[model samples]
Target: MVSTVEVPEADAQFWRDWGDPLLVSIVDATLRANHDIRIALSRYEQSRALTHQAGLDRYPTLDVSGDVSDRRVSASQAFGLSRAHRDGELHTANLSVIWELDFFGRVRRSVESQRADTEAHAADLAGVQVAVVAEVTDAYFRLLGLQRRLQVARDNESNQADTLRLITALFQEGRGTSFDTERVRTQLAFTRSRIPPLEAEAAVTANRIAVLTGREPAAVVTMLDRSAALPVYPAQINAGVPSELLRRRPDIAAAERRLAAATARIGVATADLFPRFTLGGLVGTQALGFNTLFQRDSETRVVSLGVGGSFLDVGRVRSRIAAANSAAAESLAAYEQTVLIAMEETEDALVRLSHAQAEKAILEQAAEASRSAALTARQQFEGGMVGVLEVLDVERSRLDVENLLAQSATQQATALVAVYKTLAGGWPQLIPEPQGDAMAQR
Candidate 1:
């Protein structure tokens, strides 16, 4: 249940100012260029056409015709008596109307079935839209995470360099042991090694975003040179009950639409077991010359009606009904499964965000303690109270804690993205409007 208490709108300005421009652009591009969405739209169009065709089944068809011809026959082959070398011209004009009388409701049922299918396709399109939004959001957050991690690596590398320099200077002056100097140098090298891999990872993520945005990878890489930081959340978050989420989820709606379509198909199959009726009429004039084709004396009219039913197709109709029922059942199952998955995702993201926040708090304390211990060790070593190894060990612990803090921050950002994905609230609004001139320039 939604809370009756008023909830203020979230202030996502940081995410908006930094990531929104790129994320919106990418989401719009993906919506316009994604192959699957395009395919689904085409399928919807096809269903609309089929629905129109089905509706037409209840109407009469009119055809107009006109023809002119010349004929010659030998006297011996002519009926009765005819002179040799005889030629005649014939001209005819006609109008015909044909209609199927749907007394047994077969046409009505077919039309209903096609209408249901059309609705199903429309829902499928909506589902595709939701999926695309989720994917783009996830990618954008992941790219941000990678960028932040790279920054952390760089900062850690710089810190290690500073520590190594201090240790080397002390060792040269005989104030620190050789082992302490070597250990600092080793840690510095390891920190530096991390930079290259993190940079590569960030590059790969940028490329993936580029592909989603339907742009060249190099172009995205050129555009994304800014530092990455985790996004801040609003003071309040609203998570309605399970029912609210189920109703909001696009996949569940799509599956339900499919079930409706399948149920309609059963009606269509059942209608097929009944008889069909058709009415046809022809009004025409025939004459030996075009001048008399429309004359009252030459006019002829005919009206015909037909009804047909298949007595041998009972088994086939029953099989179709059974298949449609099965399909409806399958769709219901799928809808339930989608609901379960969406709930699972929301709960998991919530847990992760809370845990990461707690972890960040602990890690902050650990880092502060390590920093103090390192400072104390340095003072002790200068006063001849402790060895250089003690100072080096504390410094290493501090660096590790700092790295863990950075990781936790990234995890929190990822959790926020996951929450957005689960909610499926972002759509055309979250994505940017198209700028024709900007796109043309690109």
Candidate 2:
């Protein structure tokens, strides 16, 4: 039996793989509102307009013009009269045509160069997306980590305070030494010092996220209230092969587009070495009065074809071609360098994540063991099996281990974000708005 319901098609998410709903919403908002993204988008729009403008040279342009004049001249003032210096009111109008015949492919190459530039701008926009997304993710996780660290420090301070009270009462009763009391006070003071720095960093990170989302720094102060919740994603993606980097990296694509544009510009420059063919003509009527302007006999027509080129300035044209060649060569090198940097970043992030995960695992076990040992040490000290110094040492070790574990976990999360940034391949193709009919080429 056929099902009675239809399933909806899924649309592309602002990002992929990371499945946190809040993250998805924030990223979507940033992509829409971020100033850097808007700037890149505007540059892409300009390139599109320039591409259409460049294509305009491949067609003839027609212009309509007219003039009306009253003239008077004396026969005696004429040097040699062809009808004793005729004078009259004159009226004229015409439609003019001008076209550069692109026999040397100059116009075609120019259009190609501009089209490639447009593609480069599109890729640049995507690159900006990758960077901004990575930044927001890093900042979000950093804030969470700082909050956790602050909580850990405050808890340690509270624990120290309890220990200090116990030592103070014992000392007052002549059961504890002065050294113990002073040691506990100093430990509490040290624990209290960590909170301020952590609080500062968390506030700063929160402000950064707010700005990233195009809001005031105070707008998102309380937006992320959760503590140290790092959503897990695959540590290693199953990318098919290294060749996929060519398609999956926006920087690489942008560099390749730049190379292509430079190569096409070489053709544009080389074409200038040859004579440029031109066609021009006018069609209209010229009459002494407006009443006869449309008369058949008064009709005027013209047609012309000419070629113009620089013979003495050939050195300048050659120099331009040489410059274009150098530009293409530079672009090629830059493309290669971009690919190398992309690979380096990917490998670095992957290795760091792997080691961070391993380190975090070890620290997790240490943290548990340290907490258990500290608790046992406190019980033993109460029974006089150990001194206050021993208990203090164990508690300090536990605090340090907890802090390390928090940092390692945060590093691992940010490393994943970096990996995603390196391989985002480019955002979904954001096609520019359709150009007007006026820009259409025939």
- Please give, for residues 1-442, the per-residue lDDT of candidate 2 as tens digits: 1111111111224344445676777777787799998898889888887877787888898999999998876676675776535678889999999999999999898888888888888888888887888888888877767777777788899998999999999999999999999999999998998888888888888889989988888777877666645555343454345688667787898899899999999999999888898999999999999999998899899999988876358899999999999999999999999999988887787687678767866887788898899999999999999999998999999899888877876887687677667767322333222431110110
Which ten residues in a row are the worst by lDDT in model 1? 1-10
Off by over 4 Å in 2: 1-19, 74-88, 225-228, 425-442
Candidates' RMSD to native: 8.0, 10.7
Query: Which predicted model would earn the best lDDT?
Result: 2
Give the Cα-based TM-score of candidate 1 against the true structure.
0.81
Clashes of each: 0, 1
For model 2, give the 10-residue run with minimal summed lDDT: 1-10
In angstroms, the error of model 1 at 262 is: 0.8
